[model samples]
Target: MNNNFKMIAKTLFGFEEILAKELRNLGASNVVEGVRNVSFDGDTGFMYKANLCLRTAIKILKPIHSFYVRDEKDLYRKIYDMDWSAYLTADTTFAIDTTVNSENFTHSLYVSQKSKDAIVDKFRDTVGRRPDVDIKFPDVRLNIHIQKNQCNVALDTSGRSLHHRGYRTATNIAPINEVLAAGLLLLSGWDGQCDFLDPMCGSGTFLTEAAMIACKIPANINRKEFAFEKWDDFDEDLFDKIVESSLNKTREFRYKIGGYDKAPSAVRKAQDNISNANLSEYITVERENFFETEKYTEGQLHMVFNPPYGERLNIEMETFYSNIGDTLKQKYPGTDAWLITSNLEALKFVGLRPSRKIKVFNSHLESRLVKYVMYAGSKKAKYNKTIKE
Candidate 1:
């Protein structure tokens, strides 16, 4: 029997292509990239694997139905007409999350309320009871996306966003999201081939993610639970087999991954989080000012970090950024350094031309991930050659 079905993996802006590539590598069929999303076809076991392994996905949604509606009345009628018992029981708890892009449905909250009432009324009319709504920890979460006049209803397979990777229990201020960190690392072309570093590693998000990628470990291996586990049709045996198989595929990582932070507190937190992820064997954290330190490793070095991006550029920030360029150029050689920051004005002070710049978002802030390549030979010789040219 063919159990294949369509599923959508939601992701942050500028990650659709990455997500699509991940899906294809995982054996997804008919992978298509959409704006901030990737749609593909897979089975139940594949769904489990996607939630467990996809590093760039925020949520994996299994679309059940789609329809066209004229108004709230039509929406309620269509929703109430569907067989809700297939997914929900009289005792089960569910929640509706609605997104509105249609002019007819202006308010999302009101749409959710009306849709909830429709489902509740359908159950009460036939089953003599209705499931209660649990907003925080719903057993079965549903997504309603209305674009212009079409509505798409999908079951939320991975709940609370896959960014909640369940590894970092302690975090510093302005910690990077796990998915964002992973995406940035991929964009920077870090494939666990050589040494990796996060110079200003706040809470060690980059360190943890880099180690996981290097070892080919599943992204959500440490997560406690996924929303699909709560579904009535969830197969424990299949999920267990998938988990074991994914773990068996992890490759050995021989390269070293390191992190450095000036603050003692940040170092401790990073060490704690790395230990929680069981990656202490492959990663190390230390307290050191990035500007005063030289390259600790030999050969090609791959560096990615999220530096402090103050709201507005000041003299202090300019000097801080300038020091970043000076340290990279003078102390580090044969290194590919990448950093993401929202402070575009401060980036000018870095005094180095970026080889590549990609537009991304760190939460709501529009940011840029820029890369600089430092040659291994004498700086003066390179400068002289350029001046002569």
Candidate 2:
């Protein structure tokens, strides 16, 4: 049996702690969290599981080598001296992505260039040929990190971001990232225990991700490929076994997962995406305006979504947010609602106090994931009273 080794899972800012928790729950050893990243110990099969199951992770990397370097010459020498044959061959295509935080190497592009040169040159010197570079779809994707005089090289196991999930073929203007959607759901302590809803369900990303989580479905079950499949030692049988094993672990989900959007077009797109994800049997999308709708499920419901944060402070933003609060308080009793937005002022208009406020990012915008709980048999959501026109 293979002994345990360390691997790093990179995530969005503010998700490291939750991702670390996920790793711990997945049976990772020596789990540690860092800024936008988490480090943990697992064997080869566990590495496969982490790649296939971790939703918050953008990429999973296995460190190949690390050492100190003074300049580009030293970088090339050390990299060229390593046994590249163990990972790649002259016939294979590869890509190098470099990140540098040192004054000595300000340009990451040059670092990638130099590192690629060393690898290719080493292959030519040793095997009388060179490997080809394939940036679009590489056989092996390598990562180079240089911080001052220290350097670390890692293999990218998940070629594309794990957020791809290979399910979302339809998208609207502001479709949320799958990883962010899943992370926010996990942050809300959502399990399969309760019903769920995404009121402003543009493209139905939140609903789909929530259903997948609730059912314990493998996060990447729909993903087309993983970088490990392209490696020299790619284990097809082992991967098939892992996939089967993971699929067998899926739990039954009895509760409903629902979504709504006022725009018929948005509802149509959400329905299409949900069908593409093959979750139509489990998720239902409709065209009802959230303000006019009430809780459909009789038991406790979990709500999470992204509402429009008016960029220009339009009156509709205020009305929309306020309507969100009013709907929750007036109609949806025994529910916990969580929404993320960058518009702090607009969020204030909602009026209901958020039980939790977590800092997160939607792409480049700084945002907060805020939650409001309407206890069972309690009053509906609270919002600021409006004056008549």
Candidate 3:
């Protein structure tokens, strides 16, 4: 029997297309991109694989039901009417996560409370007992999304956001999110084809994600657990087979991935996080000021990094950005350098026309991921020629 079902992979703001492509490449059917999300058809095994492999996905939600409600009373009535025993037992613990976009349901916390009461009341009436709510670490996590008058109820297959890849225990003051790092690398078109570098490599998130992508390794391979594992029907044998198969698909990467940070403490933390991901064999971290260093690798170089955005650090913004342009233009050649920063005004000091600029967000801060292409020889002539063309 075909066990195909719809699943939604939640992602960051600008990663809908990337997530859709990833889903298609992973053999998903009917892949469709939505705003900050991608929906596809997959089975149980595919669900496990998506959680394990999708780098751009924040959470994989299996939508169970959707309905239209007039108000909180209707919402509670509909929720209470559903057969909760199918997903929860009297002894199981569950949590409801609500996202509200409807005028009727103004407060998400209040909606969650109403839904939780419905489910709890249903269980108590039918099974003589009700499952307790565990907010932090629930066995089965449920998603409630209200858009206008419609409500979508989905089971959260991957808990706590897939960005919690379980390998980044040590981080600097403002470390990039793993999903954002991976999405930026994808957007920059870094396909593990050549040498890679993260010059500002704070905590080495980009380095680890780059190495994993190069080697075709699963994104959440190091994660301790997924929310689906706590489900009552979770098949250990099936999950084990999926894990082994995913591991078997990992290929050997011959290219070098390197990271550099000026601070010794940042270097140590990056190294430690890289080691935690068991990627020391493919990545190296060193302490070096990025502006003073020249390109050490030959041929095409792919660079992606997140520099300080002046939010948490006290630095001269204009000079720092100007130095970035100077270093890339004078020292690095035949390199495609990409950086994401929220400092738009500081970017003007760089003085290089970007080949591409994509709007993205670094957490709540609106940011831009800009790319600069440095020609191998006669930088001035090449840039002028391109501009003239």
Candidate 4:
């Protein structure tokens, strides 16, 4: 039986393409990319696989219905008309998440309230009982997206954001988001071919993500649960089979991946998190200042890290960035170093030219992922002309 249905995977800015490619590679049919999201067709088993394997997705939503809403009353009526019993029971707790971008619906809170009312009233009128709203940990979560007059009602299949990959209980002051870390690694063309390094590794997010990517491990192999597990029609045996199949596809990684942090606390935290992820055999973490240390590998090295962006960390941006450039140029040869920072003004102080600069957002702050290529031997001396953005 063909039980395929359309699903949407939400992602951060500049990751739509990578998410789309991930969807296609995961056997999604008719994959389509939208702004900050990707739509694809898959079955229930495929959905489980996607939530487990996709590294760049924030959430996977299975849209159940779509309609045009004239007003709040119309929206309520449409929502009330849905067969809520198919998804929720009187004993189940539910939550409604709303995103609005329409002239008619200016406030998402109001939309959520109206949708909740509709669902509650429907249950009350028919079954004489309704589910309670539990925002923190709901048995079922629904998403209502309003774009102009069109409304998309979806079930949140992967709850609590897919970035919570059941690892990293500890974090630094300004830890990078796991989804963003994975996406940045993918954008940098990291395929685990060469030795990998995260110089300013904080809580080892990049290191964990890099190891997973290198070994072809499912992104959420350690995740405890998915929202679909709470669904009425969730098939436990099928999900278990999917998990085993995904694990069977994992490949062995031959290259070494490690991290270095100047701060002893950060190094300890990184080690703890890496150990929690069970990637100790594939990654090494040490307390060492990145600026003072040179490349350890004789072959080409791929470095990715999120240094202190100067917002939460106290440091002179210009001097820090200048030292970064000097160390890369003087010591780290035959390496491709990629870093993301919100301080654009300080990026100019790096002195070396960036081969590529991509616009990305770290939470609310706008940032750039810049790549610098350090050549080997005398060829490094030839990189005199600095390319300006």
lDDT of 4: 0.94
The local distance difference test score of model 2 is 0.90
Tens digit of per-residue lDDT, candidate 1, span 1-389: 98899999999999999999999999999999999999999999999999999999999999988999999999999999988888999899999888898889999999999999999999999989999999999999999999989999999999889999999999988899999999999999999999999999989999999999999999999999999999988999999999999999999988889999999999999999999999999998999999999998878899999988986323389889999999999999989999999999989999999999999999999999999999888768878989999
Best by TM-score: 3
The list of candidate 1 runs beyond 4 A from truth reads 312-315, 378-389
Cα lDDT of model 4 by residue, 159-221, tens digit: 889999998899989999999999999999999999999999989999999999999999999
Residue 368 deviation, candidate 1, in Å? 0.6
**Candidate 3 lDDT, tens digit per residue, 1-389?**
99999999999999999999999999999999999899999999999999999999999999999999999999999999998888999898999999999888899999999999999999999989999999999999999999999999999999899999999999999999999999999999988999999999999999999999999999999999999999889999999999999999998988899999999999999988999999999999999999989999888999998988999988999889999999999999999999999999999999899999999999999999999998899877888989999
RMSD of 2: 4.9
Clash pairs, candidate 4, are: none
TM-score on alpha carbons, each prediction:
0.96, 0.93, 0.97, 0.96
Candidate 1: C-alpha RMSD after superposition: 2.6
Candidate closer to the true structure by lDDT (higher is better), 1 or 2: 1
* lDDT against the true structure, each candidate: 0.94, 0.90, 0.94, 0.94
lDDT of 4 at 280: 90
The local lDDT score (0 to 100) that residue 51 gets in candidate 2 is 91
